[model samples]
Target: MTLKVTDLCIARGGIPVLTGVNFTLAPGAALILRGPNGSGKTTLLRTLAGLQPPLGGRIEAPPESLVYAGHADGIKQVLSVAENLTFWARVFGRRDIDAALAAFELAPLADRAAGTLSAGQKRRLGLARLLVTGRPVWLLDEPTVSLDAHATALFAAAVRAHLAEGGSALIATHIDLGLAEAAALDVAPLRARAPAPDDFDGVFA
Candidate 1:
């Protein structure tokens, strides 16, 4: 199944953040969302991930078919790296954790407390979580936020492989992710007024 958005509009309060946003992504395709700060990059990604409601739009996604990996990573700081990945693996019913960790170069930090790992290390662990799940769709917001060149390359390779396997990705990032044959969507022009307090209804509307 493909992910599609039609006539999507997002407002923070009463201010408009996104207007008439529309796009469709098929399996094995990747879309790189390029936008400056406050341009609704995160907002659109969140909306597509089903974390937020669109002000006026329609979305189609299958149950448990999509995964979101944002800057926060959705990680448990209290758990060790391995424990964190294990939790996700169990949640997603994945059979292999070591392979995922190794793929992300997180084997060494597997037992380290997530709170103790450096930013880049934590990000890598987050990617590992995504890999273990083997989900078909990925909604990544700044996935490479804290990664170095090497780690970034690793992430790129993994994403490429995911696409090769017929998985789709919609990534919001300010930098290049090195995805081959990926299309770029610019969201900067969609920015407008901030949503108003009363406009909160639009978020769920």
Candidate 2:
């Protein structure tokens, strides 16, 4: 599937943050969104995921085919690793959990309670949920947070495998994920500019 955004505008708390943004992501490709803090990368991803409406323009993609993973891991503290994946698999109407568990090397920790895992372990489990989601387009925000070098490489490999299987991803992160041929989008240029002092004078009228 192709995900296309044209002249997109995004806002946070009703305040415009980004405007005139545009991009197209084809199957087997990825787009990395780079920007400084508070630059609206997360807001853009959230809009694409349909968590919030775009302020303007259009996004052409099937809503049901997209899965979003935010900075939060979204794992149940009381659930076992395998059980957590099983629950998501059921939600997505997929019956298999082995692939996802093995993909993130979580098979060994399958029976471990989510609460007992370290920060990195929990992040891995959070990422593993993507596989079980059965959705093609992944919208991830800072997916590498708290991950060490080795774990980051593992996550990169999993993403590469997904793209090889014709899946696409839109990632918002500050560091390199080692995804070959992935396009980089610097959101700085797309950020909304505050109105000039003279322009704002009209608001007070």
Candidate 3:
């Protein structure tokens, strides 16, 4: 699967955040989005994931082939770690949880309630869902937020394996994920300039 973006523009709170972004990602490749806070890295990822509409431009990728993991872990606190994975697998019409469990090293904590797990453990459970989804394109936002170095290594390994199997990822993060071959895009240049005070006053007045 391939994802192509052309002249994309994104907005937050009805104000433009980024404009004129373009990229094409092919299978077995990854793209890392880099930018300071409020630079629209998350906005771009959200737009690409179909979580929000783009102000302008085009994104060409099959809806079914994309899976997005945002800043939130998206785990049900009441459910056990294994149960959460099972639920997602069923939602995606799959029946395997072994790979997801082993991928994030959650096998030992499989039976533990998500609410009882530490922040890092919950994050792992959340990431484990990606493998179970069986999607070809991954849109991840700060996926390693609470993970330690060892867990980060595990995350990198999972991503590497996915790319090796012809899957692609677009990650928005601040730290290195060890995906050296991945293309990088710095969103700083794409940030939209705020309207001048006079322009805003004229419009409001």
Per-prediction TM-score to the true structure, in the order listed:
0.89, 0.94, 0.96
**Residue lDDT tens for model 1, 107-164:** 8888899999898988898888888887899999999998999999999988898888
172 in model 1: Cα distance from truth in Å? 0.7
Screening candidate 3 with a backbone cut-off below 3 angstroms (N, C-alpha, C), the clashing residue pairs are none
The positional error of residue 184 in candidate 1, measured at the CA in angstroms, is 0.8
Worst 10 residues of 3 by lDDT: 196-205
Better of 1 and 2 by lDDT: 2
Model 2, 64-172: lDDT tens per residue? 8899999999999999999999999999999799998887889999999999999999999999999998899999999999899988988899899999999999999
Better of 2 and 3 by TM-score: 3
Model 2 TM-score (2 dp): 0.94
lDDT of each: 0.84, 0.92, 0.93
Identify the candidate with maximal lDDT.
Answer: 3
Off by over 4 Å in 3: 198-205
Question: Considering only N, C-alpha and C atoms within 3 Å, which residue pairs clash in candidate 2?
Answer: none
State model 1's lDDT.
0.84
